[model samples]
Target: MTVVVTPLSGSEKLRLREVFASVQDSGSLLGYIRTYGFVRFHLRVAIGKCIDSRSVSKLESFIMENGLLDRVEGNANVHRWSEQTQLEKGDSIAAGHMSELSGYTRISVTQNNLQELKEIWDQWGNETKQLFYGNYGNLPYLLDVQIDERLFRALAQFWNPAYNCFNFGEVDLVPTIEEYTALLRCPRFQVDRIYSRAVNVPTFWKKLMAITGMSEQWITTRIKEKGECKCISWDALKGLILTHPDETKSVDVFTLSLYGLMVFPRALGYVDEATTDLFHRLSKRVTSVPAILAETFRSLGTCRKAGAGRFVGCAQLLLAWFYSHFRLIDKVVCRVFFEDYSLLKDIIVSTRRVNVPEENWIALLQNLQSKDVEWRAPWMIPGEILYRCGSFDWVPLLGIWGAIGYVPLLVLRQFGLRQFMLATHGLTQSEFAYRGADYKKRVGEISSAWNKTCRLKGVAIGPTTTLEYVEWRGRRVNDNIPEPDVEGARPMEEYLQVMP
Candidate 1:
């Protein structure tokens, strides 16, 4: 069938010309609405950044030139390719793929109630099939890149089962002006690498407030509200922890993950004080990391079909939380927190019975051997994390949960030729990793890294090397690393040797 294009009618043409005139005259909706000079100027930067005159013209032209305004063809002609091709294509291609992706990424909800939710989560780390962000892309790209299970297990190499939401609150670095601006600036604001990093906050209070208001509105509305439980109720989640240590529903986990994504960044000073305090209080009430893992392990027998997405996603939160909250050992901290040193030691190293698979159990133990913090400093590389979790004597550096008023602890990881020589009677690349290069620059850079928002690298390497921990006075801190002893602590090689 041949389709005849309708020309813009006189009246329709006049109306469109008028709308276009207004759109260009103001350069924004707020402007087109005819706000006062003060308000217009305040929103000018935001308006310019957000408004796409070219796209708006395309939209207007589509309605007039295609007879969409008159509904000549109604919804039938709407889907056809035209000047606004991307709009229709996005509806089918982007939106359709997103929904399909959501289905694939959703946790296989085995049971509706908390009991089955708990079981599925316990049997696996999470109740869902969505283990990683990339899982959505997995099904579509399966022919090209086979999803690897070992890639998921890498985090196991660094998990400390002892440290979850139970006693931990997500601590994140404050976003620097540049990082904050990078997040806030409109996508069209092209940054010249040479001078872009220098983008500073507005000097005037009104301007700053306006910018912040825009940011808050933008951040708040970006994610759609599920209208379900915003977070696991403190009492309900806590009960699950005491009565059901090793299981959790994916919904609760995902809710808390979203909650953290919004709250923790603001806590780092991205938002108002009231907002920060409210989120901090909420953080205290949610489930702990250890508790989540416990429930996950307990349910492993049943949720065999579950995906790794939720587990990996939430677990990364803990890693980033641990690093962002890292504290150097101070005199007062050593005296007050470690006063009951023996009690602390027993809690971590005491022998206990666990029902997890041998390999997984050992991997969790290895994760505790070193905290694989999500954030990294400038001078740091993976190997330079000095050995704080010495196979024999070192204590695993546990994280301090802000909600519980726990103190962040750091410990010295000092080992020389004698220790290195005894370990293998040979030199290794690990020996000189932490040293060399400009130390001051490293400290500055690491400090700078901490000021950025949370970025988690959930991979675990079992050397108790902390990427960054420094005092406000700029002194390097050495708090004791949390090195708890698991019953079957042995070399990774030993575990592998007996594996196959």
Candidate 2:
């Protein structure tokens, strides 16, 4: 079972040159070598450090001049000889299963260089950690790397759920003018070291608007017209922003992440006037954090661009609406509007991507929670949110709706009229006795009215079932209100003006 191996010949130089020519980026470098038959690059220890332009050209000419190309032709030990040839060409020497160093003297300098490389790596690692950039590399390299999921999670936050966007992460941090100049001067290869820590950071929406110099209004009109509420992903917004001339400013990843958190949801039309007002107040509060303000503006600009003008107005119009409308807890509404956003930090921490990073799912859940909190903040949930937001003119109706716990219950009756009731207990099929007489009392009155109407209209009798009170918008009508025309729902202002 002995295996005989062929050796490489100098004739393979052409093939090696072709393979090297195919190497594009770092990833391609490995792939090319593996696919292109036992190809490898070797450099003299002294010349390796200086193998650029002049030196490489000199070696190429030297190889071609020698009959080295013919010497490698179909030899039994060619592979072994070729391996040795490759080693001899570089600082390291190798043949068959053995390898030796051609330049042992450079070991001290190499050790020193190794220390310097470690220092640079450490510096980049610290900086990346500070910016909360995610670890990115091939599986083998990154598998052993300690990936702080916290950092990955934070980086994921900048993604806008509506738009399927991603933050640029560490990739945006290109070499500065000074860094580039140093790279050009430094002989020891530093390119790999510099780019190793690079990850993509998201571009904020405002940054995009700034570059395009598109007015906030134009964006809003288009977005609304497109009917794409929250459809613009943060990544798309970033790309668009970079294409603009005026707005192409470099921003840190953390700042952009914060910006996304504050603005992306708003852009998606998840915000109400009160929520908008809250953001405005938050804007004033985080003035020291100008990136926050920048993010807010960009988000608004994106929404405007996305055609969410209604939302942009909602953010600014809430305060005015508060002044004009006399509601009981105007102060409370103001308080809830300005509620602390710190809770989002906890939610962010708890959020997880099942397998792949899912930005939108986490965002929707967060938006739902935030809205629920905003609605409940005013009343302390000592009562109900829907009941309070309704602000119905009739106190008894509010009491009735509130007592029902806002859950719709359906019940079939022996009588001809269908009966529906609000239940504290949300719909359940478990057999249970009806203890409270009040619900039946309420049910009786509704049945009587329904029966009276049916008799007057001469309608058929059957086992009437409750469709659920949540659907009962008619109870919302009273002395101050007429039967809804069903033509079209009136605008908020007209509807409000018709009431007290």
Against the hidden reference, what TM-scores do the models get? 0.20, 0.17
Go through the candidates in order and give each one's C-alpha lDDT: 0.24, 0.24
Per-residue accuracy of model 2 over 1-500 as CA lDDT, tens digit each: 54333332342333333333233322322343343322223333212233344443444454355322332222213223323432344211112322121111110000001222223224444444333222211111111122222223322333221111221211001111111111112222222111110022122234324433456664453332214222233443344333444321222221232223222233332221222222222212211111222222233223323323222211111121112111221122221111212111221121222232223222322222111212112211110001111111100111111111111111111111123332211111111112355554543333233222110001112323223322332231121111223344332222222112
Give the C-alpha miss distance for residue 166 in model 1, angstroms.
13
Q: Among these predicted structures, which one has the highest TM-score?
A: 1
> CA shift at 312, candidate 1, in angstroms?
8.8
Whole-model lDDT for model 1 versus the true structure? 0.24
| Poorly placed runs, candidate 1 (over 4 Å) | 1-224, 228-402, 405-491, 494-500
Best by lDDT: 1
Model 1, span 1-500: residue lDDT tens: 54344454443343333233222222334333443343334333323323234434433454445332222122122212111332322211121221111111122212112233333334544224334221111111111111223322332332211111111111212112122121122222222211101123222222322322324443343322223212222233223333533222233333232323322221211222222222232222321222222223222211222322333122222222222223210111111112112211221121222232445433433333222222332112111112112221111111111110000111112110000111111111111111247433433332243233221111122333332221210221111111334564554333333222
Worst 10 residues of 1 by lDDT: 415-424
